[model samples]
Target chain A: MIGLRALATGDALPQVKPEVMRMYNMRFCPFAQRTRMVLLYKEIPHEVVNVNLRRKPKWLFERNPFGLVPVLEYNNEIVYESSICDDYLDELYVERPLYPKDPHRKAHCRVVMAKYDKMVPSFYKLIKPDENLRLQAKETISEEMKSLEIELGDGAFFGGPQPNMIDFHVYPWFERLTALKSIVEFDILQENNLHRLQLWQKRIEKLTCVKETMQPKEWHLEFFIGLANKNPQYDIGLPQSKV
Target chain B: MIGLRALATGDALPQVKPEVMRMYNMRFCPFAQRTRMVLLYKEIPHEVVNVNLRRKPKWLFERNPFGLVPVLEYNNEIVYESSICDDYLDELYVERPLYPKDPHRKAHCRVVMAKYDKMVPSFYKLIKPDENLRLQAKETISEEMKSLEIELGDGAFFGGPQPNMIDFHVYPWFERLTALKSIVEFDILQENNLHRLQLWQKRIEKLTCVKETMQPKEWHLEFFIGLANKNPQYDIGLPQSKV
Candidate 1:
């Protein structure tokens, strides 16, 4: 479903039959990947329409004024923001509930998600041009991993036995950690005493939902490399041999 | 219930009886006001313990790792972040449901909340040191008001007829607009064509919850002025005659 190339400026809107849910997405966006993982995990029937971020289509703005990916359109109504989109999906499709049922536990999940949101900038900081800043970010990330390792404790996932919304919310960044490590040349997980987080990552990597929604590490590397060079390849993986 | 002064460094933690909900708060924090409004609206029995933000209590960090206000402690479990705390409260005390029952409508409320969150920084930008940036931020805020006005369109509240979670989520910022206007020497609502939002603000101002939790505009002006001067009075309205 994800092989389709991203549509840039002036591209005509893709047609979608009424009643079919559609997600306006960017193929490699970690934020978009959160919703994608949720969609796959729930087996919700949906259509994916990738939009080029740099030269975004006009219609994409119509769907989400922020022009950010992971916007969900269903019954002619739209919901933007990746976490909100995932929550919306989980609420609508209750067969495989991703969030905890207890209010306290569910609130705990939200708290963990908020913490993950704060920690994300550190991962991005690792790719900064300044050496000192990159080193500082690496140190920050290692500290974060140690904390997370303690949080993981004896659980296989943040959700204890299986991955929950919190797991899906945080997993995309963990996946990108490798690509970031490739650029920074620092193995954060290995260098830190984060045995539980390391094991948790391994368990997450084996999930079918993760397998179906994740892009290759090389693809992430190429995308980030392009971004660092200031010429982001929004349509990185599409075949262009014929052209 | 809010008359108590803020506790600073070395201040002892207030004793909270078992099963009683406690909120770690700051008197003038708009973020904390959201949860305060909800607790009032739902008539939830909770204790308020204000913390001086600049010289925070060590126990405050123990309650919320970020050391941010609006942390809820119930049953020995803590939930930080205003939005999440409100959501948790709403879920637990469902008598007067703050969210819509329909999934799509609820998601729409969330989208609006996200937009409000994005718009909030511009309000703070009005107090920046750079004149050009402040002017730009004012313009941005005016444009944001126009968009919000359109979204409000003919509805009494964003939740339609009655205030909901979305209203509480956004109302705190609107409450502070007057103080911001005073500091910037600009009346955004009067200058801009945002009749609906203006009317909505008036309506929100009249709510019992709003009246109960809100500080006077003069207090907000004082707090914000103190903030701009790099010396915030976290205990602004407290009596100093005894000392």
Candidate 2:
């Protein structure tokens, strides 16, 4: 399991090892995880420098003006934003080629990713303890899932016959489904209606890259539930007692 | 001048010419205009089908699930979203490659575009008749323009030497700057503070594609001001009195 460490104001910046990629990440950040999944899938030679997002180091801000991650440091240049980082990685290391070769299909993949990207706010709403908001979020998720089912269309993955950018981009959200489920207790992926999505979830988990990178459901639930309850130490990456 | 014709229910769908590309656009939509500039830049032989956003034709929805322009129809298929459409065009027609060749530079171009895209809502705020919101929006635009001045960094365009995807993606918002200037009377591109941005603007206007496609300042002012005043005929693509 990945762990988080806080970097105070004067903390030493992580050394940039020659010829190795560095990823600045927060263990529980879905956005960071998105980039990490790509690196893991590509089996890129890299080092992970976990940052406690609450107390960001000046170096991180230097690397990324916005001070967000996952920032990829390679060849003496740093790039942030998960999608851009993923695009950079995919283009630089073309062993698997995440995007499709056909221009229209590539555009289609990007459009589908944009559609699901809009659902992130609704996903956050589900983690709220409020029942009304939970119901609303669930409804939004179901509608999005229905759209996903349609987008999946007879293909094993969004790109057909293999997982591509669309699948990699969206999987992080579903990785937290177990956490949301424990709290909201609504079955978003019912087999009767969402059998395709259900199967897709299982298939994704079987991948070694996903399995190795994913945090257990307990860690997600604990962190998110504490976050909802206004627990300040939620980001300490440990239980309240430990903090 | 390209004319504005609203395609409503029962209107004939534009013929899919055997070899030509078709663009579904609204004359005034900044997003739609992004695609037009690209088509004009490439001088790609294409047709324009203007959709009535107010009462969208069924055919528009049939082609695009969101019924949004600009939709590119070619080879018996359709794709929407300005960025996606522009990407498709750039890839399919490589004569004038809108994107950079190097991977890092391409990512950098995309990141710059994403940064400017966030400024649109603030741009709309300036169009509001309310003074408080207008001032707030002005501050946001100033900050963004300052950042733009930094990003321009001795380059004629966001991409060195010539305009690329970043320049085209961001120009639409600035296209309306003249209209906003007439209404809000705030000079964003001050000669002293924003000289680089101001110069960049003039450089863009000199491009034949931009010159051919841009609506005059007077037209943009009338439409956006009417829009701010809650005029019901805003979407009719006609002046208020005509409605």
Candidate 3:
């Protein structure tokens, strides 16, 4: 029986000395990336099988009755849900912690993560070149950034100088700010005056482990287009994008 | 310091004493009602604050940063996020276990819950009454329910004869099936030979404590209609005329 545990988003998990611990996920899926971030951060050595989410590999459906990504299989046990996977990582490898020890801070970080997962991505999906929607996306995106900036105000990142679990959980979605700006002509990235967020992004990007697990840029754009096109089962960023 | 612990969803949570743990939630909000069901099954003494979806209480925002209901304030500690609140409840109280004893089973429950939370609700929201969308919702709802029925095949509920963490997590949304039959006329609850699900609903509803915590029927219907209208946060399940 695997013991219960907790780990946050992007902490490199230490590679367990080779026992069949594998992660079933897709490269472009943000939820998968949550677990991937933990794996790379923990330096946990495991097999990575990318599932064709649209076609959904048979084994994945077999392993996961729910048929979602970021399904982590450790030994004979499988833990799914990106947040739960983060929890498993925390329990599996205790050396380096990503989630905070403080309860209030932890709750707040998760709330922000949940907000990003539930609401922010809609700006990326529902925004169109329509004159009104474009402005709406920009304003919404900027507002979110401003609020998040206030939350991260004096800190270098979400959790002080170092990127904590909340930072790891949200950074990928925040990257979509650039995507939103590029596609929607909404310069929310610059308008929010998200000084710390910008620096934090650069800092996180420089992390070798995160870079190792980062998805291809085009894959994301392609996936988003599919989701926007009304493709069923191709949900990448729809509300439940994160764990 | 709160010690790290785990428990099943429907299990009795740790108690500071009688009536101190009050939860503000409703039966319609998939997230909110999930914890409500757990509290009832766990036999915890809790005051249910029924917030009007349209006119949410001012105190809810103070307890919740996002102003969403389903906030759990106990012993001067506040935890938000419906699932997290449920988990926190289980964490604090372990007499009745909501989380599974096995890590693997727990993982399965989490994914199933995540799928309902993310996939089911997101799909439900995007659906409009247009011919194309209605048809699409039909197919989508079918696939969703069929998948869930298979998950629940031969089980009394999601986890077994007695309701478990996953059941409380997933049931509330599917319970929408009941309202959906009246409003849009879907077949999961009506057809599909899902004898188990209907029975499951009765069993869940029959719980003395569970039935007591539910919100007013008129409010529920209005809320679903509002969700369909996108006027309020969720669909309150009233007739479309009210909408």
Candidate 4:
């Protein structure tokens, strides 16, 4: 334990050079993927422990009372909220910056983050079908995609010239739409004027860093498709790999 | 906007000279209120602008694409995400610091913050009058309340001996439970393990700072009651303060 005084005055970000952060995570969680994306971007080496939500590791329960994953364990500084972890990493590592340095740009970045978080709850509603939520998700995805189109405009990634923290934070979830396009029906790309979104998706996944960090796992994609297809009301089209 | 370099290098905390933060807020939003609670706790003052969500101010919309209340504009820095704003203020403000200085305690603080953000979505589902959802809300709320109790166990606030950022973040939403108790059939206060939770709620509210920053207005409570009434499937009893 240290006071603000104990922390080195000249140094910012966590100055204590410790081993790589011990990451508590799983492959399927997009939230966890967001953190992993940061690690890949920062080039921060860390031990990754995958946990089965069904039978969570005891250490997980000990470290995380809430019983959730994607917890980062550094020397002593542990951070939560995948996006917060991303921000913290950006602060600590300046070599490859992710967040925008402008306030309006930062707030714009948050809107994209909000778009991703908003998708989860309604998206889960489709795990079991009901007209209102299915219709609601359709409308939301449509509007969100449209919003993303304008937000992205002519930008290569969500970030203008290069992928930044916002790109890594939101792109993985959008990748799910690509994987399960056929399983759920919505003209999100169409209605949202987001043809650019699909293009950007391809660009992000093909990044040398991103490609090095990951490979296509057909099972995970298939699983979401299976989940989407199980519902009676959804007539999501067959899978489309825009990427 | 300040660079990550400026953000880290600033002798922000514990320095007598305070950094001013401009806050766009709404008194009634539990999310927005969390920021005010932290500002008051840290003893930092800022210019506050009230935003109407339905009719969002153009400045806010232009400034914050998400346009959510409690947008903190500091030293040419614009930070969104309520939890971000809370932690940022603590990091930047010079007096009455509310964050735990210890790394482990900081991790624990984040665990609690992450839990709050994660639980909020599901809990919002409770407003809809669906049998499964209502049950889930109660179950989820009860579960979180239990966690809060253990976290607070014989301690005053989330950070022992002080009502830190997470405590302020959680309390305003839990206060809504008080309003909902009037409508829902469950007695969260009377539950077996919630006795400590009930005690903590009262203890935190007694803080002069919290009391000043948050108060239950008759209509706002009615607004929540009205929100709860949106789902008509289940029977609810709303005690109308004005009528």
The per-model DockQ list reads: 0.91, 0.65, 0.25, 0.15
TM-score for each of the candidates? 0.95, 0.90, 0.70, 0.65
Question: Which lDDT tens digits does candidate 1 get at residues A208-237?
Answer: 989887778888999988888987887776
Chain B alone, TM-score of each model? 0.94, 0.90, 0.76, 0.81
DockQ of 3: 0.25
State how far residue B50 of model 1 sits from its true place (Å).
0.6
Q: Mind giving the per-residue lDDT tens digits that candidate 2 earns over A153-213?
A: 8888876887788888989888898666766766788732898988888988888778877
Candidate 1 lDDT for residue B195: 77
Model 3 per-residue lDDT at B39: 79
Candidate 2 wrong stretches, greater than 4 Å: A1-10, A129-132, A232-243, B1-3, B9-12, B17-19, B232-243
Write the residue-wise lDDT of candidate 2 on B68-117 in tens digits.
88988888767788888998999888898998788878887877777678
Give me the overall lDDT of model 4: 0.64
Error in Å for residue A142 of model 3: 1.9
Residue B25's lDDT within candidate 1 is 88
- Report chain A TM-scores, every model: 0.94, 0.90, 0.78, 0.77
Calculate the i-RMS of every candidate, to one decimal place.
Answer: 0.4, 1.3, 2.6, 4.8
What is the per-residue lDDT of model 3 for residues B18-98, given as tens digits with 9 covering 90 to 100? 337877665466788778777777777676554555555556666675767687776676778888778767756667788
Clash number for each model = 0, 0, 35, 6
